[model samples]
Target: MATYVLVAGAWHGSWCWVEVARMLEAAGHRVLTPNLLGTEAEDEPETTEPLHRWAEQIAEIVRQEVDEVVLVGHSRAGLVISEVAERVPEKIDLLVYLAAYLLQDGQTLNDWAQRAHNADAMTNAVAFHSDGTCTIKPEILEKIFCNRTSAHFIDFARARTVPEPIAAFMSPIQISHERFSSVRLGYIECLQDQAIPLDMQKAMQAPFPNVMTEKLDCDHSPFFSMPHELVSALERFRRAE
Candidate 1:
């Protein structure tokens, strides 16, 4: 069975992957959904640690696996998984970007977000805090992220949503061709995404070499909106590899 390391995006913890993890586990694949630093609680402010530290935390988890891992990152975590692959390239079987920001070397999430058509709307929907973190406004969570998801799932996400570290978004990732290029990459695009924008997702997938691409006709949160489809796509990608 393949080992899957699932990473959540900004303002999310391992809780966001519960359904997906369950589905994968039922299929006999080992799945890990670790909570990133500063995302364990809604009240915790963003830590001052650099992005590499967060990447190291994830790398530490992957190091425990006995076999190579299928590393999956959601939303802003596309950067985290990329850095993890750089740190532990030998441990990764494939890198999957689930509607995430697949940034290149020296690029920051802020750089790509600025080019998105809904940047203004997404920025305005956030409540910036004094502690260099921000939370999405509750009133617009359904409109922006869960527009196509069920009410129960949307409410579940809204309740668990937390403030996300801004430093991670501002920090530029450093990936080397020698280290990161060897890992197999894949991208899952959410066609109806409002937060990242469909066009920007396509742009991010443009640079990867021999990357597999799949399209989900859902909003930004496909795990909640279309868990079965997401699981099927992930299975197909793994089998194809």
Candidate 2:
């Protein structure tokens, strides 16, 4: 059985992975849905937390695990998983990205957002603060991230969502071909994703060859809207990859 460390995206807590974790655990997988540093709703974002810190935290989680780990990241969390995989490539058996921002060595989330045609839906939703924090508008969150999701989940997600540090998006990622490329990459592309559209998802995977690809006909947040399909895809990675 693989130990899965599922990292949450920006403005989201580990709460988002509750249902998904439940399903994975039922299938005999130990899942760790760790809320990244400062992702809590009540936690005040006084100072900016950069990308490396997020990556280091995940790396530490991987280091403590004894079983082969499948490191999964969602949305903004893709950058964290990629950096951590390179940092401890030997421990991470597989890397999974769910409509995430998979950047190169010098690329930042801002760079990819600018390139994505439908990024306005996500970028426009951001409400930046003078204190160097930002959050997505609640109204826009429903349309972009939770489109077609049940009313219950929409409320659950909104209430738990918090402000994300601005520096995390602006921080340039550091990954190398020698270390990062050695590990296998799997991407679950959400075709209807308004946030990170299908085109951008394919473009991000283009740089890396033999990245096992899977598609879901749902929106950006598959774990919420189409969890069964999402878990099925994850299981496919373990068997087919």
Candidate 3:
């Protein structure tokens, strides 16, 4: 069984991947979904810590487990996973971006978002909180997270989302060619994603021309709207290796 480390995006915790994790585990693939530093309720604001500290958390997971892992990053988790790959490239077999960000060497998530802006599409969207933490307003959670989800799941998601750290989105990515360039990359597109938008997803894929790509006709949060399809895609990709 292949080992998979699933890192969640901003404003979300390991809770976001509970169903996905179950499916992978049922299929006998060990899955590890670590809650990023500031994304958990108990992880009090350490807005001062640099991104490398987050990357180190991921690297330590690899160091404790098998040498290499199939690293999967969803949404803003992409930034953290990429940084982890930079520090421990040897510990990653494949890097999967699940309708996620793919920032350039010096780019921040906001920089990428600016290029994909659509005021009409963003009408229901909200960014940043009073404390400078970022979060989607609960009213727009359905549109942003799982537009097609059952009302039950939508409510669960809205309640679970934490206020994301602005630093995580605004910080410039630091990558080392000696590490990142050697790993294989893959991308998944959430076709109905209003949060990132379809156009932005395509743009994110442009940088990794050779990366394997898969399209899901679902919203930004597929674990709720299309869990089976999402799990199937992940399983297929893992076995393809």
Candidate 4:
């Protein structure tokens, strides 16, 4: 059995991976999903946390365990995984980007999202707030989080999504790819994703030519709309080795 550390993107918490984690656990793999800084309303501005701090957290999880881990990152969490791999290369067996932001050295998550070449992106996407928190607009959430997702989830998200710290968005990502060059990379593309857009997903993933890319015919948040399909793809990829 392998241990899997799943990291989520902006405005999300470990709760987002509930279904995916259940499937992985039922299949006998250990899973860990932690909430990032500034995700909760009560949480203070930890988004100022340097990129290394995020990497160290993941590294600590791997260091305490003895099993090889599959580090899976979704959306902006890709930045965290890249840096984590650089910090603790030995513990990770694979790096999986689930319609995630795959970035290179000195690139910020904003840079990837705002690339001009992609035609499908929400060009006006903004993540800032006057109170110093970041959040997506309610209208944008529907397109990004899957319109078919239950109204309950939509309501919950509308009420709960705290403003993301600007640091998480503007902070430059620092990664030493040489450390993770040997790590196998995989990509799961959400073809129907309106938030990231199909074209942008393809563009975001183009840098990693060796990655195993699979298209999920669901919206951006497949974990909410099609848990089984998401689990199935994850299981297949996890067991591929």
lDDT (Cα atoms) of all candidates against the true structure: 0.89, 0.87, 0.81, 0.75
Error of 3 at 112 (Å): 1.2
Error of 4 at 141 (Å): 1.5
Question: Which lDDT value does model 2 have at 216?
Answer: 94
Q: Residue-wise lDDT of candidate 4 within 1-241, one digit each (tens)?
A: 7788888777777877888899889988898987765566787756566456777877788788788788888877888888888878887888888878788788887786666443244544555577666677777787667666777667766776656676776777777758867787888888777666678777777777787777788877777777788777776677776
On residues 103-146, what C-alpha lDDT tens digit does candidate 2 reach at each position?
A: 89988998988777776666788899988899889988888898
Please tell me which model should have the higher TM-score, number 2 or number 3.
Answer: 2
| lDDT score of residue 192 within candidate 3 | 88
TM-score, prediction 2: 0.97
- Candidate 2, lDDT over the whole model: 0.87
TM-scores of all candidate predictions against the true structure: 0.97, 0.97, 0.93, 0.89
lDDT of 1 by residue, 37-106 (tens): 7787743654575477779999999999899999999998999999998999999989999999898899
**In candidate 1, which residue pairs clash?**
none
Return the candidate ranking by TM-score, descending.
Answer: 1, 2, 3, 4
Cα displacement (angstroms), candidate 3, residue 240, comes to 2.8
Worst 10 residues of 2 by lDDT: 41-50
Pairs clashing in candidate 3?
Answer: none
Model 1 earns a TM-score of 0.97
